[model samples]
Target: MKHPVELLALKQTHEQCLAHADALGEALADMRVRALDAASYEHLDKDDRRLLDQFAYRYTRLQDDMGAKLMPAVLRALGEDIAAMPALDRFARLEQLGWLASADDWATLRQIRNAFAHDYPDSAQERFERLQAAASAASQLMDCLGLISRQMLQRFGDLH
Candidate 1:
């Protein structure tokens, strides 16, 4: 691939992914210091709520960028035609290339992300459950980003 521009795009996407990953890590770490329960969740402090918002926003952003932008850029850089490939197939191909851990895990994360997008105002329990599941799944999303980052570094070397 004799395309410096593609490399530049890939580097930019990789940087965005890393930024999301770092934010997610910080939010999760700050959150873990004080665990949450049904009662505690009902009342979160301003900072805690902000952290939650940060985590939720970044989780969605990271996955969306990976699936929508980064994945296609990566495939193109690797000499694959992804002009018409669906999202899941893109994940499958990344997994095949050893850039992703499991396409299934990525799909599960997508489901969790979708849950976050919808609002059920009258259902606190449902929201709490989703927060619980998404928090756990958020770590997995981080892991996936880490894997892709390493693979990118190996393939492209010092994207910065």
Candidate 2:
């Protein structure tokens, strides 16, 4: 790739996201094994609750940073004329270029991440359900990021 420096920077960001995701997953592993429902969430110790909260926050941040920041930077680095395009169009272009499996999935992942911003203090059940969904969506986002990274390396040549 002509922009090897930019590629290296993107790789660094990718590595950071991977580390955050791995840490969050490790924290959630024990709590997840318990099959948490709303009632189950209520019974969790302070530390476990904190971990769950971190998972929700960090996952959304990861998704947002990747889509809004890392991905657009990547597309530009690859010489895609995406400066005037909306975010959806950029994703569509990435999909068309075979870097992304589905642009719709990327958009849906953003929607799912955004849903986590709402607070359902009045409905514990709804909040718990949202958390569950966010966790699953976060996993999917991580997989998609991995796929995109691999594709980028294959096309641009791995700098590392």
Candidate 3:
């Protein structure tokens, strides 16, 4: 039998990615609620805005890292040609395998991740909006990835 160390490592990484993705999703939801309350109640204080901005930045980075982790595992699971896949095509294939919801949100999340990582000095509000969308998509992606990981584990038996 194959040693299966690589498969086991990929599975572990997938689990970690899902955990971080879920945490980021929860933080984003909380931030969204706070944002809505602030809008309804009054303008957010500078400190509150800063907090949201920071969370958004961190969450975007987390999602990006999770995606990077998931992609290689997904390629291994499918035994497919990763290079042949376009961004959307890769997402779609994952979605078909129950590893994602759809390509649209995943693509948007990638864009948001790029913006947060590279585009500095953008308004807090803009970043917040992007984060909100990315968070929702990340949540869905987490669910799908978690399911895929579980299935993989079952197929190969538990990793030592």
Candidate 4:
């Protein structure tokens, strides 16, 4: 790749994104082991609380890095002018370029992330359901990152 230096930085961001996804995935796995309901959710053990916290933190970090840092870096590496592009514009451009599967999907994922971030469910049932939804969305987001990784490999033939 002509942009060896640029690809190197992209590679770093890509690895970091993967790490976040992996951690989130593990948390989701932990989530699945517990048959949590509203009541159960309210009385989680310390370990369960840690796992939930991990899930929330990793999910946000992964989305933020991918949208705010990695996506722009990817565009910049591909010679696109992304300095002024809104995040939605970046997603649309990536979709138009055949890199992203669908910008709409990305928007949905963002909504899920935002909902998980800001929502303080008044009902334990709502919190339980929200956690379930977030876990599914986290898995989908991880898949999206995997797709992006495959695309990167196809384009550059090995980032290292």
Candidate 5:
């Protein structure tokens, strides 16, 4: 019942989401390593701080973009009303679509995103800890997205 072109676009977006998820996983691992190293040093050198800052920025940006792409795909596969659904309803839809286990963690991640976007400079230590936590949550979310993409491909077959 879906148009072939639309399906193709969805497939492409799904693939991109999967790829971004992989990148996020890698970034999360890197963040953990950096956090450990920073902790071991007991103080961040200027270069170390800069690296952490850059990594946190890129990790958050990529995670947000992945979510942005995913929302559109969900709308395409389901319906536009999904955009306006309550958080619980949205989570249920995402779960039904096999894209997430639950939405609770995602809400936390979104809060972290908002914090990073709006109030990152309150304290370096606090921001670092927040970014680390966000990285972990984003990693899990990316895994869910990857699973959904796989399920979708299996259900719909390869578009190309």
Candidate 6:
């Protein structure tokens, strides 16, 4: 905490992650308006299909980047000693500290993410279900990011 350089580095990294989350949240909002529910997948037009495909790609990337990169960096900026803990324990601690809603929610997000990653192109029903779920999860993930961002601002003031 005494080292200005170290603090500056963390602030910069944290800001970058916050910016990415903000961008992804905006994209998700746009996609949500155009996205179809699972019940309507069979009715999507050609244009809708194109839009949905783009949404699917962005959703998966946003989910992956947030979990793999952004969350850990944010945790570190918040003074979490993540390097010493296992991933599950780290998430559990974040939950305990109110950074995450629950460890189980984090686990569910991971499962949804994995489903997206292994999706079969030939299975329309499965793909539609996964996209619908991912779209829902994207909003929840944004809420989590918002909570983390608020806590960061309260703890560190303007991170910029």
Top candidate by TM-score: 4
What is the full ranking by lDDT, best candidate first? 4, 1, 2, 6, 5, 3
Clashing pairs in 3: none
**Compared to the true structure, candidate 3 yields what TM-score?**
0.63
Whole-model lDDT for model 3 versus the true structure?
0.62
Over the stretch 1-160, how does candidate 2's per-residue lDDT look in tens digits?
6476777777777777777778667656755775678986656778767778778777877887788777876787787777689988988888887877899998887777777776555567877888877888877887887887788778777655
Cα lDDT tens digits, model 1, 52-139, are 8898888888889988998888988888898889988989999999999999988988988888766554566677788888888889
Candidate 2: give its CA RMSD in angstroms.
1.9
- Name the regions of candidate 6 deviating beyond 4 angstroms: 1-10, 35-50
- In candidate 4, what are the lDDT values of residues 1-160, reduced to their tens digit? 5477778888899989989988988888878886677788978899888889998999999999998878887887788887788889999999998778899999998898888889898887888888878888888888889888988989877876
On residues 1-160, what C-alpha lDDT tens digit does candidate 3 reach at each position?
2346557666677667656666666666666666554133246777666656665655665566556666656666556677666666777777777666666767776776676556654465665555555556556656656676676666666654
Residue 140 error, candidate 4, Å: 0.8
Error of 5 at 5 (Å): 2.6
Tell me the TM-score of model 1: 0.92
Clashing residue pairs, backbone N/CA/C < 3 A, model 2: none
RMSD, one per candidate, in order: 1.5, 1.9, 4.1, 1.2, 3.4, 3.1
Worst 10 residues of 5 by lDDT: 34-43
lDDT of 1: 0.84
Report lDDT (CA) for all predictions: 0.84, 0.76, 0.62, 0.86, 0.63, 0.69
Per-residue CA lDDT of candidate 5, range 35-152, in tens? 5532443466786666566656655665576566655565566544654666566666676666676567666777777776677555556766666666666766666666766766
Number of clashes recorded per candidate:
0, 0, 0, 0, 0, 0
Q: How many backbone clashes does candidate 4 have?
A: 0
**Using Cα atoms with residue i matched to residue i, what is each candidate's TM-score against the true structure?**
0.92, 0.88, 0.63, 0.94, 0.71, 0.76
